[model samples]
Target: TSSPTLTFNDGNTIPQLGYGVWQVEDDVAEKVVRQAFEAGFRHIDTAKIYGNEAGVGRAIASSGLSAEDIFITTKLWNADQGYESTLEAFEASMDRLGLETLDLYLIHWQQPKQEKYVDTWKALIELKKRGRVKSIGVSNFTKEGLQHIIDETGVVPAINQVELHPFFNQSELREFNASKGILTQAWSPLGQGGELLESATIAEIAAKHDATPAQVVIAWHLAIGNVVIPKSVTESRIRENFAALDVTLDATDVEAINGLDRGAEGRIGPDPAVSD
Candidate 1:
């Protein structure tokens, strides 16, 4: 079976499962991203802060897929969060990606302390209006942060990319996204390596499906309806993570995994409200 997709409020659809390039070095990002295409990933997530958009652009150029066939998403860095600066930064990112239009563009972080995200959000709206981006969203935004933009612009973000996993599910934020018609895109979907995979419960579930722990974790994310993006440079793991599309879990299994939520203690990434 192929990967499934979720619809955005804007009438665009995104592949539910995607590959991320958070820490993947630029020197090797093209190779790794090309490997993801071979592994059946159509959606790719990157950021200006990741310092790998050029490599990502290179991989896309050689993917043998048309622009419409792939979903390319990149983020706006915190340093360029003002209205005019955000527009300028968008141009730079577009130049690096070599794309006339981006599938999705996100504010990498709220950077609420800068007191500029509200203006930055306005820039994203302008980009969407001019058709530079098919969809625009935010990453690491709190419930209040998301509402602030919606209230200011009357244009809801298509998705909220956040750190979510079996451990830190961001239930409250996810619920709010659901209610507000915003998709929840998961980053660090595997809990950033073998740490969350070490859980005996996850291991047991993996055994039940005859799959790897990473696959089980990803399946759990899809089962709960979050658009998941797990980053890995290993070719085997890239292929393995995509295989979550075929894995299915039962209510009993979902309940067991949901039991792993440790609330605030399970968080593995920086708090969105405090993070850059």
Candidate 2:
């Protein structure tokens, strides 16, 4: 049951396989986070917008696992996209999570229209300097936005999390992140809208490996060097997702799955550029 980890630019490491609480209820988040821990998941991703960080904090308190043993990630919402506001939001998030230090803190979205992410990035940089957060990154940022932050702050993000799945491989964005030494992380690793779940190609490969379709997709992300976090409130599904760490996909299988890309239209989430 060994789960691989990826090292961030900050010299800290993150579990490649983790659990996320996107839409899960607060009460259910507590129990389900415990289920994920019991199932061997050492990483947990949450955000201020999730409205369940307190429940997640409870799960951590009851899990009997040391804070150092868990990799927790949370994001700063778009409304909190300025220097002081980001710091305030981070404080609020930390209070909710009940943790002294954060493993990873990210800008949930660029909000380019608001034109405040640069200030947000600087606040994160300061947080890292103060030994508050281990790593800082952005989510749903385009290449131009990423470059702007790096140029303005001269500090590259340790990771860039975006909507990724077989149906929208994000090949170019991943390549760009690689060039900049930023790890690309997959949120919604299973294609949203359930479109990729029923693919015959995926089913065939899953059958060959005697793994579930979800596990096959997760392995594909791992094999490609993308950190993946799949969310599920159901205990069985949480355990099922953790099992993806054990499955290894061959080049042939990975290439076949890569063929599922649906280009720009496949995006189930909003485009970050205009999201503001």
Candidate 3:
């Protein structure tokens, strides 16, 4: 009953179902992350912008799990999107996380307007070459941005984490990522636990499968093959979301959820193309 995993193009595998700590306070992140571990999540997604990497590191230290037992992913913030700056930021992040080697490191945003992601990606490629990080990838990158990096360096990203949910599935982007062997990771898989969770369709599907609306939505994400990271500060909710690994949806159910896509209107986060 553990979380499933997906392999990156580089041959590294990531847990498909991970616990995310986006808005959790730094002081509280350690407690909730510990709760997530106890609930059986082995992968944790965090970012420098999230401001909880130190607490996350504390939980990892206290969990009694070896470094290889967990998959830890952290991202480089937008402001640090240059060659030397990215390297410095990685060192600072490592100092905060208390880790010698990182599981994955990502360019948190393309920040295309800044016109530095190409060089930023080179730094990540260099990190991978030096074995500082096991895998390197990007987040909030559009297809154009992804192509630009790949064309510039001849290296494809291993993953692309973005805001994805039933409401804003990003089917076209997902297809493009798949075409290039980049695994798509969902940042807001539950749509911030608002209207999407309250949808009549999700409620009906949840009742049909004897699952919570959150689990149903998560299962839908799994069915469509996106790595999902759902965050919750409450212990009970954390455990409940992890149990989504057990929720199985039929083809009909998957089709019904797929029908919920709201196209561009459903996006809840900043558009990567214009974010910075």
Give stretches of model 1 more than 4 Å off.
Answer: none
Query: Native-vs-model 2 lDDT?
Result: 0.93
Candidate 3 on 205-239: residue-level lDDT in tens?
Answer: 99999999999999999999999999999999999
Check candidate 1 and list the clashing pairs: none
How many backbone clashes can be found in candidate 1? 0
Best by lDDT: 3
Q: What TM-score does prediction 1 earn?
A: 0.98
Name the TM-score of candidate 2: 0.99
For all predicted structures, in order, the TM-scores are 0.98, 0.99, 0.99
- What is the TM-score ranking, best to worst? 3, 2, 1
The residue-by-residue lDDT of candidate 1 on 1-276, one tens digit each, is 567989999999999999999888887999999999999999999999999999999999988899988999999998888999999999999999989999999999888788899999999999999999999999999999999999998999999999888888788889999999999998988989867889999999999999989988998999999999998889998999999888999998888998888889989878888875
- The per-candidate count of clashes, in order, stands at 0, 0, 0
Worst 10 residues of 1 by lDDT: 267-276
lDDT of model 2 at position 222: 94
Clash pairs, candidate 3, are: none
Identify the runs in model 3 with alpha carbons over 4 angstroms from their true place. none
